[model samples]
Target: MIVAKQKPIEEIIEEVKDSKKLLILGCNECVTVCEAGGKKEVAVLASALRMYFMNKGQEITIDEHTLERQCDHEYLEEIRGNIDQYDAVLSLACGVGVQFMAEKYFNIPILPGVDTCFMGATEERGVWSERCQGCGKCVLAKTGGICPVSRCAKRLFNGPCGGSTKGHCEINKDVVCGWQLIIDRLKELGKLDDYETLAPIKDWSTERAGGPRKVVREDLQA
Candidate 1:
């Protein structure tokens, strides 16, 4: 899951200051799950924008819409006619959704209403923790489902590094040593022997090093 936070209302207001007509666009995917850009968030932002203008003795026309996914062309196409009526679009989705809208519309200024944080999971309602950096390589299989790349400050490929003390990471006393957790988990599963095998250096060239990645499945293509 991708976690993001809402941008400050002041910052959002400034972006559309000159526009009398505005569209507040939200997404029904990851941003929705995180509660940052769902239908409720869209209404909140639109209402706030309207209130701000009203307090200034100026009237602003603001429309709210939540798309199934702003990142997909099929979903975005539904707004083709509606978008033309707005002077600018204030996207409440993740950074990818904002950019996708800009790419599709071309003529309008698409502004982001949230800051993209990280690939994370909901620890509980209103709490999210970073889990993956999307480093292009996945080593969770060997790490007993613990990710050192994201949780360990050192990102040590084989480590608890020399810096770890007891079971805690040296960089932050609150953080558990990722490698220690991995070792303990594997031990419980009688797979501790897996630790002896050193993982090969990740070949980033096949991952993101080459540039934007894509997958084409002929069977899925109509």
Candidate 2:
């Protein structure tokens, strides 16, 4: 899942302070799972903004709206009727949703309310960790299902870097050595011999380094 963190209240206030009417938009997708930009968060932020302006002797029209997904055109279209009522939209979705809203509503100011983190999974209650880098290639089959690109401090593919000591990453003692985890998993699968087989030089062009990537599936499209 895509994880994100909310921006500070002060920064959010500053972004919409100049506007008389503000729309606090929330998304019910990944942000909801991360507890960053969901219906509940939208209400909290709207109330905070209202209180801030009220305390300043200002009267601002603050409204709250959450879409099933701001990233989808169908969901975003729900606001088409009254989108002009607000001076700007404070989107609590990820960066992608913010940009999508902007593109769909070219004249309106679509401001981001959260910083988009990486693709990750919940580690525990209130805790999340990075899992995949979307490298455009899958190596988990050869590496015992552990992602070296995202797990490794240096994105090493071969083996534990010299900097790793006792299965801990040199960057931080708390960080597990990605390669060490791979080795252990391979041993469990009786594929330890695969460790000696070197991974071919990675073609980074397949990643974001080349440009914005797109995958078109004619079968899935109308």
Candidate 3:
């Protein structure tokens, strides 16, 4: 899932303070799972902003709205008729959703309310860990299931580097060496021999290094 963190309220207040009308928009997707932006968060932020403006003797129109997804054009269209009522929209979605809304409504300002973090897995409640880099290449079949790109300190593909000691990374004792995890998994699968195989130099152009990437499915297109 794409993880995100809500920006500080002080910073958010500064962004919409000058606007007479504000819309605290939320997305019920990835940001909602991370507890960053959702229906409840929208209400909470709306209340806080309302109180702040009330105390400052500024009566501004602030509305709260949440869509099933801010990234979908169909969902975003739900607000088109009423969108003109607000001066700006404080989108509580991930970076993609913020930009998606902006692209759909070029005439209105779409302000981001959360800091997009990364594509990751929820380690547990209130705890998340990065697991994928979306490199546009899948190497898990060759290196067990664990990802070395995001987990390894050095992103070593073949084996654990000299910096790894007893399955821990040199960067920090608490950090587990990603290569160690891969080797252990290989051993369990009786595929330890694959460890001796040398991987070719990675072609990084398939990753974000290539620039913004897009995938279009011809089968799904109209």
lDDT (tens digit, per residue) of candidate 1 on 46-152: 99889999999887899999999999999999999878888899998999999999999999999999999999999999999999987777889888888878888
lDDT of each: 0.90, 0.94, 0.92
Clashes of 3: 0
Worst 10 residues of 3 by lDDT: 151-160
lDDT of 2: 0.94
State the lDDT of candidate 2 residue by residue for 13-97, as single tens digits: 8899899999999999999999999999999999989999999999899999999999899999999999998899999999999
Question: What are the runs in model 1 whose C-alpha is more than 4 Å off?
Answer: 206-208
Task: Give lDDT: candidate 3, residue 153.
Answer: 83
For each candidate, give its TM-score against the true structure.
Answer: 0.93, 0.97, 0.96
Task: Give the poorly placed runs of model 2, Cα more than 4 Å off.
Answer: none
lDDT of 1: 0.90
User: Which prediction has more favorable lDDT, 1 or 3?
Assistant: 3
Tens-place lDDT digits, model 3, residues 1-222? 899999999999989999899999999999899999999999999999999999999988899999999989899999999998888999999999999999999988999999999999999999988899898897989898888888898888878889999999999999999999999999999999888899888888999899999999999999
The lDDT, on a scale of 0 to 1, for candidate 3 is: 0.92
